[model samples]
Target: MALSGEDAGETIDIVEPAVRMGSYLAEVQPVEDAAGLIFLLWAIQQPTIARPNAFVRQSSMELRLDACGHQITIVQTPSSMSNPGVTGAVMWDSGIVLTKFLESAVDSGRLVLQGSKVVELGSGCGLVGCAAALLGARVVLTDLPDRLKLLKKNVEVNVKERNARGSAEVCELNWGDDLDAELTEPPPDFVVGSDVVYSEAAVVDLLSTLRQLSASCTTIFLAGELRNDAVLEYFLEAAMEDFLIGHVDQSQWHPDYRSQRVAILVLVKK
Candidate 1:
């Protein structure tokens, strides 16, 4: 078969690996034999360029997780790598752990989800907030403006069909910004975030946002991946100055889903 519209000799030489292997044989070749070498080069080189892109175009995937006997369906981007800078694009292990913990807590009567006003910070994929809405809490899932689209889509798909007792809303919440006038009137009774403490620079802003929404009776739950020791340590140290922080034992979560790398911390306004 024809390799390129270009000359066969030039094409064969351009394929470095084929040329090296065929160099000795080429010395003995008649003019007609060059076409055989050209075909071999074509066969080897086509796959390298013809292969489809490994990363799929941006799209949402539906994932099913059973929490508190309720099957939660969350729609989110398949891979964070597909869209960088949007940590909120995918569901994380910390979010799963937190969601399971919330389900268990509500079922055991340790927490009151019913009628409680809840706000979630950096609600990546909106899994934790959707779980809260499933459990009967009036939930607001907040993220940076750029992240709101995916977060809202997840909330819509997961929370709407459940016919949940509580309603779910999506809003913009930039940590450290003045609490929006609407978010202030009825201060949230509970503040929750999953895997939100990834950056040292954002810790102060996160804490400020938490402090703004918190009152004496408000409780905050922050679930984070223990991947970075320094970042986690810095958050705890800085947050201790303003809030009483305590770790929730893994034993408190569903046995099957417990993980050493995931931590859920409860913070009360001090």
Candidate 2:
């Protein structure tokens, strides 16, 4: 059940909704009604829901930037393996918008990407790389091998404009398997991930994987959905051993649910 309000004590019970994969690339969405939301919750309670795309999509993340005046057409693939459509995985606040914001920040000189070889962990549709490539930064789109099938296809599909404009690489990166050789490049100046710390062990693995994939003093930028601050806090506590937790952006959905506001934290390697 989606907690509509802790104050009001309202939870949208979205456990099971009709799931259909239409066109190759459509969009992701949330449950529209309480019953639908409850159905989704029920469905997710089961163990089989490893991959959750907007099986019954009802919302989306807009990619146009009015302030920066950046325009990019992003077409996403079916919600299956790669598009892990949970709040952190594929929700509007977490996935598309967060990735877009991170990319825009990097492009705007906020994150300092003059000559950084960047890697996006769990790059579902490769939208982050699309924007990063536009700014002349070499980005590696990384995800699981099975997911990479559609990932490569999505990159080929959505990034025509990006590729025509410049260059980026699409590759397979399993967390602890073969970080250095698979990407076939220098250690990433930084590693970025969004909504990746779902389970407790996953959070630990994420840190260990980054330690192996980057330099001792490597920089890392992560945008979490903040399903619970505990996840961010857990990561921060463990991450402090190798790097400093720099800045964090925590966001909340407005009362009307029309827009999302963010509060982010940035962590710098010490």
Candidate 3:
């Protein structure tokens, strides 16, 4: 079955019978009422037991950026849930929301990406980084060592193949580790991340890396799914020690992409 919406202007094919309705809902949570109802009705009609050989191991997600008028395709591994250690294998809603927010921010002249230097932390699937590059910012996509293979592939396919106005290079970045001179030579114009804050332990390291990457003029934009209030609060409290932090109101987000479960924050070093 296929589902499409006016706002999204894209058709999604429902092909995995083995997947439960809840699984589909989790994949596209915070969907509009119309789409949610459609998914519900479709789920009601599927058989209880999925047929054999129905699983698709890989998929591609497409994000169309209106600001740059480019369609970015990101290849994702379908078993992110099973491989919890490699959460970066798939694209998350927070990443999607952040990418669209960047596009909107650029279009409205609220943010300038053209010719700016950008660094993306935890660049899962390289979605946000590639979007920034397409918007004309030179970007470095950084993640843990294992995630680089897929991250590099997505960057190559979306940014390099398309010949984006700006450029993107994939690099390995472990939180709390010393950053290479090239990454912090003059400090980036912007440091962006999505879904990077998850655990209390990682918050300290994340902030350490953020401090290392930021300059007085650097702007940091982080988008995250509001799953754990305690963790988020911990990150916010720790982050405020060295930076002036503010939330990007939902009013400023892309209209169709707004979600109560997602938050975008703007930070700058003190």
Name the best candidate (by TM-score): 3
Q: Candidate 2 or 3, higher lDDT? A: 3
- Residues 46-66 of candidate 1: C-alpha lDDT, one tens digit per residue: 323432312112254766787
User: Where does model 2 exceed 4 Å of error?
Assistant: 1-70, 77-91, 103-108, 160-166, 182-185, 248-263
Reference-based lDDT, residue 228, model 2:
46
TM-score on alpha carbons, each prediction: 0.75, 0.61, 0.76
Clashing pairs for predicted structure model 1, backbone only:
none
By the TM-score metric, which is better: model 2 or model 3?
3
Task: Name the Cα RMSD for model 3.
Answer: 13.1
Model 3: lDDT of residue 255:
88
lDDT of 3: 0.73
Q: Model 2, 114: alpha-carbon shift in Å?
A: 4.7
Put the candidates in TM-score order, highest first.
Answer: 3, 1, 2
Report the number of clashing residue pairs per model.
Answer: 0, 31, 0
Could you give candidate 2's per-residue lDDT for residues 1-270 as a string of tens digits?
Answer: 123322246554433332211110111232233333223323333313323321223244323322112455444333332455322222334455455555555544455554566677777656566555555556788876665664575456545543434456788766656466645356666576755666666777677677776664355655544344455456666776765443321222112211122223344444
lDDT of 2 at 147: 59
Candidate ranking under lDDT, highest first, comes to 3, 1, 2
